[model samples]
Target chain A: MEPFEGKTISWGEHNGVIELSLHRGPCNEIGSETLEELESFAEVLRTSAGNMHTLIIHSVMPAGFCAGADLRELYRRAYQQPRTSGNSIAEVRNFLVRIHAVFNAIDDAPLVTVAAVHGVAFGGGFELALTADLIVADRTARFAFPELRLGLIPGFGGIPRLKRDLGNGIARDMLFTGRSINATKAQTADLVSQVVAEGEALRVAHALASQVGKFDLNAVRAAKKFIKPVPHAELLREIDIFCELFESPAVAAGLRRFVESNSPLPYLP
Target chain B: MRTLAQTTDEILTLAAQQFKVARETLSPNDDFFKTLGIDSLQALSLLTRLENHFHVELPDYELQDVSDFGTLAGRIQARL
Candidate 1:
């Protein structure tokens, strides 16, 4: 398939390995534009599964791999129409559905998938990384599910994926505490497959992709399918919980605080 | 166990080296936000560096009110 270059993301296949780069400025905050590109990419990935052996996702921005869902945009859109009119929750649910579709596509992709993470990967960003079969993090990589700070749970399949990979205890600590963990801590929890030096995540991930490519694609696909099943039921339940929480006054206040804050530590809870 | 003063000195040294500032330029009393000219994201990078150096997990929430090298050291010192 032809390479895609979009406003928020780009992708190209080289030597049977697809490299998807997240490049939106100030760290890739997933917004409508990103969702659209990801949807397109998912479609392409589904159609091109027969040709590729591995998929590597990484960010080109210095700030991080991704900062998570765009709260500013989320706030602006949510309050655009009157909350009493019931359109706000509807819009949020719609966005959640679309994003979940994209993430599920990656989660169940036939080829081996990897996330080359560095810098901040919080909230939905962390959820995105959880979709990967393997995460190769640089020393600078930090992961967290900060959704609880905004009076919401991770809407993009984070809890199920985290529980599936690291079990309930670690998942609960991350979600309940809304704390960020460094690459070393994440590796200790079995979240990261490898932790390389700073600025080396992509290079190491590429090397891994090269190694994965040498294996029989059929065996790889079958193994991935056998070991990794999408948590379809729980993911849907998470969306419902998120939407239920999004309607509360606390979520609005939290999003407002995040969007309007001038504090240097707004990323902190 | 290292003394608090030693931890503070180590933090200052790590901060200087990580941010490429002079070790002598960073004081225990200086607001690292201003001293290092770092925002929250960069501050977290510093926190990660400190955590790795000390082999401790310093939750960002605990550091919410902490801005000075001395206070930051105290937090790490407590965990240590």
Candidate 2:
């Protein structure tokens, strides 16, 4: 009935189809605290069983899906950013690194990770959908990248993931504008695998998961593992550029100012 | 160059397919917003699909002009 294990994300199993719903309801918004839960959840999903085949991520809200990282967290960080917070500066630093890790795990999972999205999925929410091997969107589902609007780049691999998922130009448009595109456009943009008739997102996703559950999990895992050896120089380029920005004083000040201001422009950053 | 009717049929058909709806549901002369009740998801999917299929990228600002079938058809025609 419930979906949590020791204050972290929980998984529900039925006929070998694991539904890892985000129970951090009210918004299902990701943040410093939830990053660890996500990372741990991904591990649980990925290493579940040799026979297990699918992982479905849905939210507990009626307007379900995620709202991205908490802006309140951003504000808190801006206010109390440590001078020399090495490795991970309390909340912000820890969250940034861990969220990326969680996404990587989701992307690399042996079984297909399906994002069953409805209502609003913006910024990190969009990126979270990007982490899925496939996405099933409801007709009313809204997808967006509002980070720029808040004067921040999506720290959890929005640009890189979008580029790899949709291509560079499309990624730029999504990132620079911070506009919310509807679910169908997201599918057309090749951002998702499919879209179902309204209210059928979760149902369709579950059906697909059942089908996936019948597959040979080991072979699937091995195939994914096989793709691991390819050169990641381009990925490294993106990460390096990102890290350079992280070290930028102008960026920090700009981010601080933007977080402080009533409105922040996401484009300049 | 393709005739307007031919172009309209070609693009609209592909766009309709992107909507994952039956071909009978969409028409060159049909009213898009009215007939399709083009809500945001449907509208966006149709727009993005049309853009990608035609290799013509219509930005969000441009999308605002296309509220109905006739309007969207006209916008596509103008781009051509």
Per-residue lDDT tens digits of candidate 1, residues A18-108? 9999999898999999999999999999887687999999999998999999999999999854566668888999999999999999999
For residues B1-80, could you state the per-residue lDDT of candidate 2 as single tens digits? 55567767776677566556677777766756566555443455565456545555455656554555556666766776
Error of 1 at B7 (Å): 1.7
Among these predictions, the greatest TM-score belongs to 1
Clashing pairs in 1: none
Best-fitting candidate, measured by lDDT? 1
Candidates, DockQ: 0.79, 0.05
Candidate 2 structure, TM-score to reference: 0.66
Instruction: Give candidate 2 regions above 4 Å deviation.
Output: A1-8, A81-91, A222-269, B1-80
Model 2 residue A104 CA deviation (Å) reads 0.9
